[model samples]
Target: MREPADLLITDCSLMTPEFDILDNQYVAIRDTLIIAIGKAEEIKDKYEPKEVLEGRGKLLMPGLVDAHTHTCQQFLRGRTLGEYPMIWSRILVPFESSLSEEDTYLGAQVSCLEMLKSGTTSFAESGGVHMHKVAEATIESGLRGAITCSTMDTGPFIPESMLASSPGEAASRIEELYRAYNGAGEGRLRIWFALRQVMTSTPALITLMADKAREYNAGLHVHLAEHRDEVSYCLQNYQKRPAEVFDQFGALGPNMLAAHNVVLSDGEIALMKERGVKVVHCPRSNFGSHGFPKTPTLMQQGLSIGMGSDGAAGSSLSLFDEMRVFRSGLHAFWGLPIFDPVVIPAHELIRMATSGGAQALQIEDQIGTIEIGKKADLILIDINQPHISPTHRMIPTIVESVNGSDVRDSIINGEVVMKDRQVLTMDEEKILYESGRALPRVAVRAGI
Candidate 1:
């Protein structure tokens, strides 16, 4: 007369929030939450599971959370390689502006499939038009996301179609999207307000969007101090650094998720620290375009930092790759300088991908860890492979050696979206075919 579990995974190595690996562990999922987790032998017979996944040779851990990405930029993958700086205006804007609703949907489908198969259970859309399309793709793909609409009022080279008439219009549009999509898909989706960036947004729009997000209890996503151009623009326009501009507008808060942060002044970092602003580090994109960010310094200051792929346009939609790049870059930049090779150790880096990412998105209470009452958003990695073999130290191996291809299963919100490397919720073949067919039309429209 034991409890009936919706899904059960037994005989797996479970990863704790502390980054410790527990062998012979079993996790029981009932509906959308983890109901029980304990030693496999002691707990295997306690539940009558509707479905059971043999987790032997697999590691069950909290799925990676991508704190920032661009679903609409999925098709632009490999298009910006070796491009100059300010590709946002030179390349990305035209492409995004040219996309139709259907185009956006297709891009989202491709992006979702890439992320899910690569072990990302949750992500935050950096902001784009036709976000409903992205939301639809996310819901259909069974992934969790905080999505936002692209909001811009004034900036050089911005397309007329992408600009809002005024700050009020931008705030109204974002509020509408929040009302329509926030907490959608059984709370798997949350709508957020976007500032796009300091250069693209006016002070009025920034303040208004911040106020609206607070009113709706939603998050505000923005790119802060991401590059030299943005910092220069802010200094010229407002006589302040980019992060300082947000503080001046009273727009910095816990609900604000700022990406890149490649060029923050010490004062701005301190201000952001005081305001509890979350940070998303896009290592591949940032390092190539802007120099290395103050990741180690930010971590030392106790900022909540998360990893992001920034979308497939610049980097692969895999947090595993981001983790590797971030760690190596940090070791070279900070570690070599200070003669300390252990700068931002592997365990801490993995924490940034998991709990830190959930914290950045303000969803830690629901998803980030393997514990009872938390939503069952998890990934199973087949670690019995050649690359990850001889797993002497589990955490280091996960951070250093493991790649997205090792992800054997992905479960989000208690549903097994990908099992045995095959995506269950998404039509992979149809999406791949459609993406190939649509790219030519998109390139023509984008004038790429």
Candidate 2:
């Protein structure tokens, strides 16, 4: 007889990268990896599964990946929703700086639950002083993340808690963080180096970080060319564009993910393509910021681009919402009589949320897709609702019709983190209750 699978999912309508639906399919997981997948009838007889999940009336897809987000900011979700200057200077800075380790842990607990409920299995956290606390929460929540330690040494009015004081101090701290948590949580959690941004980071700081990332074959995440003021500062001080400074410092590479690349020049885009630098687009977050990255143009130029929510402040932890917003967002903004309004198809949006994000994190071969020999990171979305009726056509319905709340179950690393919208690893009710209580304390500590 064939080997027994640790878990089995059958009768699922599998969503493919080509946007086709494979109805009545089955997937088998052994340990933490996908061992087999095929037609439901065929696979059912092939393996003896310890546990079986009837995936009837559901859609199975590779779990979503948020290529750029701040778990640290989940604590201040609705507390700050004003304009840019105040959003950054008065709110974001103080709020982040004021987080105690416990407060940060609470943020991670709730945010990870939010993502699982919304169908995100993996995410790239953009580093914060309290990021290790986020790491602890991920370990407890069974979320896969490329998390980081926030290393900011300089910037105007930066809070003292996040300041590293010098390049050496920042480098040492990064090394310590990496050694402690780089491959923690049974290889589900990764520790990447975060530079914060160009305005605050010195060349030495990022250069050292680049070397360290390369040495370990890890990815680096940072904001690049997001704001107009950032670009102006780079030109004034670095004698080049913001992207150019990154290029010169050896920070622009395949493993580097630059978030909110809103102001890329043609040459910079070409340079990014040449360097294999990846990008993360935060559509909701960009509404009041500079502008959305020229995604259509970037896609044409052959750059690997992914989608991000930027956490609760920038957007919700829902890549489902990001997908709809991003697809419509692209056309409604600049395609008026200039080009086809439907330039980006729903299929492309799905790719950006999955395989493209995998390439961005330099883990394309591992967890992004639901293929045999890949880690078992997947979610099941319930489509037995009125909103997603007319099941004859599933792709567009999944893309445009379905929302994050439709995600009914989630499995990560061969573990069912959630079942029927109930999170299995963490205490969902307690996390929600504590998040509300911590918000006021965080704000009070920040004196905002």
Off by over 4 Å in 1: none
| Stretches > 4 Å off in candidate 2 | none
- Mind sharing the TM-score for model 1? 0.99
Pairs clashing in candidate 2?
none
- How many backbone clashes are present in model 1? 0
Count of backbone clashes for each model? 0, 0
TM-scores for every candidate against the unseen true structure: 0.99, 0.97
Residue-level lDDT tens digits of model 1 in 1-448: 8889999998999999888889999999998999999986667888999999889999999999999999999989889989987888888877899999999999999999999888999999988878888989988999999999899999769999899999988888777777787788888999888899988998889899888889888899998888898888987899989988898897999999999999988888889999999999999998888989888889889999998888888879999999999999989988998899888899888988999999989989988899999999999999998888887898888888999989999989998899999999989999999999999999898898
Model 2 Cα lDDT, one tens digit per residue, 353-399: 99888887788898777789998999998988899976678876777
